[model samples]
Target: MSKVQKPEKSDKIDNIVGMLMEYEKMTVDLMRKATDTPILEQYDLNAPYAKARIIKEDGQIKYRIDEVTLTDEEKKKLKEIGELLIEELDVDIKRLGSNENAAAYIRKLVERIIKNYKIKLTTDSLDRLMYYVIRDFVHFDKIDPLMRDPWIEDISCNGFGIPIYIWHRKHESIPTNVIFQTAEELDKFTLKLAYMTGRAISIAQPVLDATLPDGSRVQMTYEKEVTRRGSTFTIRKFRERPLTCTDLIIYNTLSAEIAAWYWYVIEKQASVLVVGGTASGKTTTINTLAMFIKPNAKIVSIEDTSEIQLPHENWLSSVVRTGFGVSGSISEITLFDLLKNAMRQRPEYIIVGEVRGSEAYTLMQAIATGHGGLATLHADSAEAAIHRLESEPMNIPRPLIPTIDAIGVQTRVQVGEKSVRRMVNVAEVVGLDPTTKDVLTNDVFKWNPKNDTYVFYGRSYVLENIMKRHGYKHEEVMEELNNRRMVLEWMVRNNIRDFKDVVEVIRTYYVNPQQLLERVKREKMEAPSGGSRPA
Candidate 1:
């Protein structure tokens, strides 16, 4: 008998490919069945896969999937489809004008490719392929879903071959399923992102900072030469409608009473500084409190990136421009320069997004001249905020720190397994303490972590100042505050939390306080006596 011939190398490879295809089919079927479960529908797949088991490892609660992956064959097919579509379309996705247009075009193009190729794929597999294709071409690549998730505070990629991490609104920081597996891929992706920001990256300039098309702030490191890792990028997603005072109340970030007090204080033209560290809700708090300013006032807001959204027609928003050289000047304009120019514009309320560097001095001087400034600062507490102003970079005189009439501390703290943002403290800058050479502040609101609530510690000196300035009696002030509180509660109860609706209510309060209050109270009383509202 003739010896049996050994299987050819190509035959073995073909056998392996056939096995992978079978595996891919099984995987697709299982995924479809898994997704069809009722529980999975309620839990958004993009939101950290909430239904999965969460393990406590490395000081974080990480959601883990034991077994779920794409086979090499599936990945190869996806790559082939993507390339074919790009070749056939020959159109720049960025120039597609709107996401809706791009999405429509992509859907039709993908369907055509599927029909022509006659590929054997399940409905679920086709859907998955379409998502990846749209992500890579029409959106932010692998992190597109995370970018669209409103609850995601941040999207951070450490480096090539590393898993991406995200800061979820509920979960603090969790690892994601997305990754950039190669240096060339990440380098090219960052360059594309930089282009979206109207900037460029290269060996000469390995660092890039930009604001994306959707207003999110992006910072990226080009290559391994600049970053120890291959490449990295972080995106701080922007909120279309920055949280309003009523939203803070609804979220329990602050109490209705505290919001009312701030409303009165802002109405009286008192300056305020919201203090907190990184990822704290300082900007959110200030942007919300800004709604308290009179709608007709001439408000000038200055910042490096445009984050504040105001409904006032008289508002002038200004953003600082970076210079041509790294930290150098070509046609550069700084926050300090904007503040100086704002002074000339005779703005009734001056809003500085953050007080970093010497701009603090000009802001304080503006506040001293009764400009009614509102700003945010990075600090742990009220005292630290004052110290930051008086210290090196800021160098505002000790006496001028008091010009900031109120300090609101926004703290992002871990409450059990969930991360929650709360206004931990609100203090009125009474005056300077002669004995201790410190900024004297009267603590008005303090957070009780045990109860997970904010409690009033003392009467607000800012409120008293407002009362005296407006020539309103103590009872009158208290009555006005109670009326405002009632309206706020009604809004929260009825879920009138949109920024525009909140602004409309506030504006109505200014034009016709009694009318608006009566309408709100009527709506509240007509509703059932008891209804569940978010805490």
Candidate 2:
């Protein structure tokens, strides 16, 4: 603690020490003179001091501290003091980051600055310091504007030197205006992310898929060998508020009539196959539509990534694991594997996230073998959706296609500068021709792009069978359907956005249509434009 007797040779140490203190923006030379002492043999080059802009804006370097020439005196003192500080805090850093490597390191950096100087890390840190000094620096903090952006559904980066891009719910995909200046910088940033997620991104593990603590999905490609351009990362963002059917209707993804009609299809125990091209919003539509199920019904949702968020109390959501515990663990369970497990769970409805391969056969067999099922697939149309399921790996039987009660196809379309997606087609799988092995389908509703709205009430052939099974006269069903439509319009007018209310109204109508219609007319009046009544 007393002046650690600085020898004449310590002058060189004091000079470097002054440079370290200056870089870190500290002013005291008394704390920096230990480097000039013969003890220099004990420590290597003073820990690289990530200091402020060495050369000021006006091109003046503060080479001297308090009128002391930087010759040998100030140099050794500054280097000695700075090394002790960095090395000591480096210990504090190791402790803080024992569990959270990168985050804890960042935290320790911030804490040390706050503890040593009166500087708050939010405004000061080596990370930010180096960001300005280092070439190709892009500030992508977790709390950046991109994370707060409501429209951004995903964030992706191929590597540094290229712009980062994001998929907006409204705009689809657009450049984020954030770019890394160099590949190395991008690689380091991605490494920080990997360490933060407690995953390794290296030559041994070239790929990483993990969720950020905030629930944002992140995928990374390790350096040079794994990805031609050093490193890469992508973030598939989750939404702030899960879109409900009404939200979809308000967004014009579907109309009230279409939503109400689908409610009928889903409520009546019909197997539904939602199909769309990649990123066309199929799973989302299925998630939204699933709100129609009876809350008491047992639903099992299976997926590789747990994306489907069903709010029903009786739902049991399951996700498949590549393997468990440790390395050498067999990659056993898959969507198909879960399907077999789902059957034994006594689920009234099996909701597969998507039928990419043979899982389609299980979904189809479930539908045909007296169990109602709901699933999504990557296909553009009803026929294509079926073909994808029936051909090759899936090889679902043509006859079983009819067992699929309906097909819902969603697609992305241009709506001005922004892109909007909607359920473009809904088809009812009516039957199969035994002689020709051909499947018959009826288009229930479709989006009429000319009108920019989905056409509903296109005579659901499946609804006819439902009516027959219920032993209701055809005339009664037509009246009931029309009456339910009026009630829905009234509910929409009355600001009844709750699907639960819709279920209630539908349930009442099912019990006694005439009474509910009379009661609604006597209570909730309808407006001419057919929108939900304003509160």
RMSD of each: 6.9, 15.1
Best by lDDT: 1
TM-score, prediction 2: 0.70
- Please report, in order, the local distance difference test score of every candidate based on alpha carbons: 0.83, 0.67
Instruction: List the candidates' TM-scores in order.
Output: 0.83, 0.70
- lDDT (Cα, 0-100) at 113 in candidate 1: 86
Candidate 1 residue lDDT tens string, 28-48 = 998987554433112343433
Q: Using alpha carbons, what is the TM-score of model 1? A: 0.83
Candidate 1 residue pairs in clash (backbone atoms < 3 Å): none
